[model samples]
Target: MEPNNDFEIFLVATPGLEAPLHAEAVEQGFADTKPVPGGVTCRGSWPEVWRANLCLRGANKVLVRLGGFPAVHLAQLDKRARKFPWAEFLRPDVPVKVEATSRKSRIYHAGAARQRIEVAITETLGAPVSSDAAVRVLLRIEKDLCTFSIDSSGEPLHKRGHKPAVAKAPMRETMAAMFLRECGFDGSEPVLDPMCGSGTFVIEAAEIALGLRPGRSRSFAFENLPSFDPNAWSSMRQQQPLAKPDVVFHGSDRNSGAIEASTKNADRAGVADFTMFQTRSVSDIKPPSDAAGLVIVNPPYGARIGDEKRLRSVYGSLGKVLQTKFKGWRIGIVTSNAGLARSTRLPLLPPGPIVDHGGTKIRLYQTGVLT
Candidate 1:
């Protein structure tokens, strides 16, 4: 498929992690990074889109703008929707879903607006629209302007198509990746997640070290688009060499169920060979090897476990364990409760920006040397 030069790609991030996302985007060689309300906007081609999806650790999803038009009323919306070149991107056999959101616009009725869009697309391109469609076309009407885009990613990028099970309050894969990046992990050194509930940190670390594409195991909505070229996709897929890491990646959880879940998830992510999961508590945790490494933990917050006091003790024990056991290793802790995190008295620097995980605002606290 020919690349669309006029389109813009937006990397949507968690609420307070826009700066990190912007930095990561620029580090990954994006031409420009514009900090927006909830994310960063970067200009790139289809290859860049693929790279962003693979390399970006903080972005929730990458959206490509297909078309836009100013519409103050319903008639203009209908007329402009009809003018969009839907046939260029969508296939008639692939069912499409229309989702609409409005802000400060005359078309306040989202249902009516979606109906107008569906009618316009079906009438103009002979494409079928269903509520349960696999592909989604998002419509945004803000300040009398309507923006249209097809969701390049069907399932949210966090799914990664690898993890089939989750523990209580599982950390998102994207957030886990970003947190690891923030801790200065580059896949060259060992990474230990002492409280790795579902092995997100370890798996993401292994993927980064080995240059594995996070999207390799997952299917995208764009794959079903009319413009999708199987030859190009196959070439791209074949070009990525499998990454094998020699360093140790370790994760431990108190619950045997969590350890089992992490093992299965790592296996699905194709990083099982690089990772080691064990059933152990934080108090019993030790560095993977005598060598210094990055230690990241996403322990239970009070909200999920319903006992802030008990979790505080757990955090205190973790801090003591880190201070006495792993002296030179860097420590990263993700939590929603600042008080609970403060219990880990390791002379921690100010926590990084907050991120939304399952509706809770959580922050990352880093301590020790980031070697």
Candidate 2:
């Protein structure tokens, strides 16, 4: 495969977040970005694929389509797979993990299809197949057409490889970045999270403000590909000069353990200089600066109604504190329960698209600059 050859690059997004991810892709200058059901598709070469994994904060995984063929039976699939130019993209020494999914097609046995592809790669391409390999080859046999792609991102982008500590039901960095975008935070102004868990939102805001790339400290699966150029990748990963922001991002929680975790995570992320985490209750929280910005919080809510009812007072206290202390700052509250959001009684606009945080469905209830 040519290093500059253009192909389909699929950016897997959290369900219900395709639009925001598409918008982020467009902003990052990806070619022909279009939002689909579970992801956004674009066309780019190998360098673009590497850059996508390196820079796109909202993408969960980046996949590059290798090639495909119409195969109706197992024999045809095996034949076509054996002829695939895998050596051009994959190294013989690198172990590869193959996974297959079949939908609405005659070749409905996913396990059988996966076995065939694995055999083809092992025998024809001379690459060992391992279930635990960092490099992944995905085969989707949909509608009798087999499409092969390589997962360019080894681990999920949200991992960031820096945060080792987390609070209960902590928000993911990818989701937090998109939600910050949805809240109209451009990283110029301060961001305060009163119920900050693990300091995800606060640290993310600080990083954005500092113009830091989310994947700067992590390694990607693309490094194992034959097309990878070490010198070029090293130059690309070299971070540009970053200027310190004038505003400081703030996070506060009642739990001292959460505060400690947030501090450690921030230091690891290299944004501790621009962030402040305090062990304080919602009612004790105060703005860090005179300038008005965004106060975004993902308050805790429960699955059971009784737990939800008990949390109403907590939500009410949060809303009351914000109303009394933060006059001009806008607010964004994330919760699974509409009732808990209603308890805030802030002048909220329509809630955003439902986002799947782990397994729970949550929405961002946003407000304009508060009165």
Candidate 3:
């Protein structure tokens, strides 16, 4: 487990968005990337793991596969865990937490497996184990093979360490970044979200256009690892000059409070100079510039059964506005209800794959440039 040796690195994707996450990894030059069920896997050492945490906007978390072995039983697992080279990667001064998941294996009890590893780390490496430790070790036992990994991103990457204000049912920044990519956004065009709640889409678009690293404002769990090199990580985090897009990103909401929140968030993200938020209803929304760009909105799709019938008019109104004023601009609407999306009558292409958003299943309904 030397610092310079290549190991398996996993970038956890938002459930149902593995393809886009994998595409992002490849675009960012991560080597040997392959999309699996829950995430994308690649080969990288500690520096690559650190760069993934700092640069990739769509990754929910970056994990380093330390090593693994086969253990058919609990006693074997404990014996093997104690022999692991923990000191090579983990800091004895920093507390650690171990989480284990077992599937289709002889060691079926995940709790018992977790306990064995926790005891091994404390006793062998002299590192304290706590439930609330910022650094986490993940163990997965499947088909009698046990694999160990470290969570290099402490908090979820969606946190972004900024955005203190949020609105109801707000979009996660990671999801927003992927959705933007899915819409064919490449940081060269304006983006407008008419029903923007706390301005997640607008802020993300502005950051992309400005070439800002998503993790620039935050610290990461990899910083606590024994393999972490301060000088190398610092050089990796150094910023280039921000690009100034010709068009500015725009967001609007009928809720004045949401507008205030969006303004505050953009300021904190260092993209206020490139973004605009206003208190305006869907019908009042217009193209921010004469140039056509993207109109992506995450409108309210009611949770209750009868709410769709009531929201049809709202969707219809949005559709009518875009048809009349936003011709040639692309549109993407995110909602959980298919009927509500149909209500827009915006000639949407087939819906995207179902995406999990805070337990609700949603999809992206998009169209080519509005005709």
Candidate 4:
């Protein structure tokens, strides 16, 4: 690869949800998009990196895999690291954080490897090293091959910068957006989250419907890179005409605090006019008076809702509400327990594969338009 050549751009997807993210990448017209084990790989320039961070809703992070080489020992790694063109990718002024992982390799001390890379950047490239820096340089030593990549997303993309008041076990924006896409929601129909916590799903739905960019309110680490072009990027970041949806997205939660957080979050995200949040339990929740659309909920699967015995009643109420009141509306319920889902008694189709939610495993159980 040339000094300034485009490398592999990996759009990191949440584990077990790679297919939907890959589908999103392909739909977004990313060139040479192919889903790898941990992420979707594509080829694009630095501007493409910015665009990926800006537009890809399902990506957790965008990693630029600058080419790797075989290194059997720390000395060889040090020599090559010192010679690599860090000045081309990293600015001398911006601080950097170096993280490493070793798997089945001789140079297996991840801490030592990270230290060497950090020294190389600080000493050889004249950059300050910081553990908390937003721009991260990642080193992976696997089977004696050392690969380096840069994390373009300083904060996780799910932060969205606009939503600071989140409820317990809040669904990540990235995961919610993909689940929304998986449910065949393309901003054409209304969306409601009866168990909306912090309004992540509702806000994401409104953003999608309004054609708002997820990263619009956030700054990316890519802006600190050596290749960053402010003028071109600013011109590219120019807002497209937003679409006005015909139906309002809605979210309801039994907790008044959750309702407050959701409402405030929607306002910060600039989708307040397109969203409605209310304090209501599942039993009291009903579909909008006139609109029949998709009902997507992320209920508490753990003890937050209640003990297992008590949760059966809660799930049952949710199921009963959808079954009786939401006729002709589609439903997508995300939870960790199959039994809890079964208690809902809604005709749930087979769920998609299990998704990693922090440490817990969850799945989205879907239903067709209800009877």
Tens digits of per-residue lDDT for model 1, 79-130:
8888888888788788889999999998898888999999998998888999
Q: For each candidate, what TM-score against the reference? A: 0.94, 0.97, 0.98, 0.97
List per-prediction Cα lDDT, in the order shown: 0.83, 0.92, 0.93, 0.90
What global local distance difference test value does model 1 have?
0.83
- Candidate 3, residues 243-280, lDDT tens digits: the string is 88888999999999999999999999999999999999
Could you tell me how far off, in angstroms, the CA of residue 140 lies in candidate 1 after the best superposition?
Answer: 1.0
Superpose all Cα atoms of candidate 2 onto the true structure and report the RMSD in Å to 1 decimal: 1.5
Error of 3 at 94 (Å): 0.7
lDDT of 2 by residue, 1-371 (tens): 32448989999999988988999999999999999998999999898999999898899999999988999999999999999888888999999999999999999999999999999999997899998999999999999999999999999999998899999888899999999999999889999999888999999999889988899988999999999999989998895558789999999999999999999999999999899999999889888899999999998888623487779999999999888899999999989999999998888899999988878899999999989
Candidate 4 structure lDDT: 0.90
In TM-score terms, candidate 2 sits at 0.97
Cα RMSD to the true fold for all candidates: 2.3, 1.5, 1.4, 1.3
Which candidate tops lDDT? 3
Cα-based lDDT at residue 67, candidate 3: 85
Task: Count clashing pairs, candidate 3.
Answer: 0
Colliding pairs, model 4: none
Off by over 4 Å in 1: 1-3
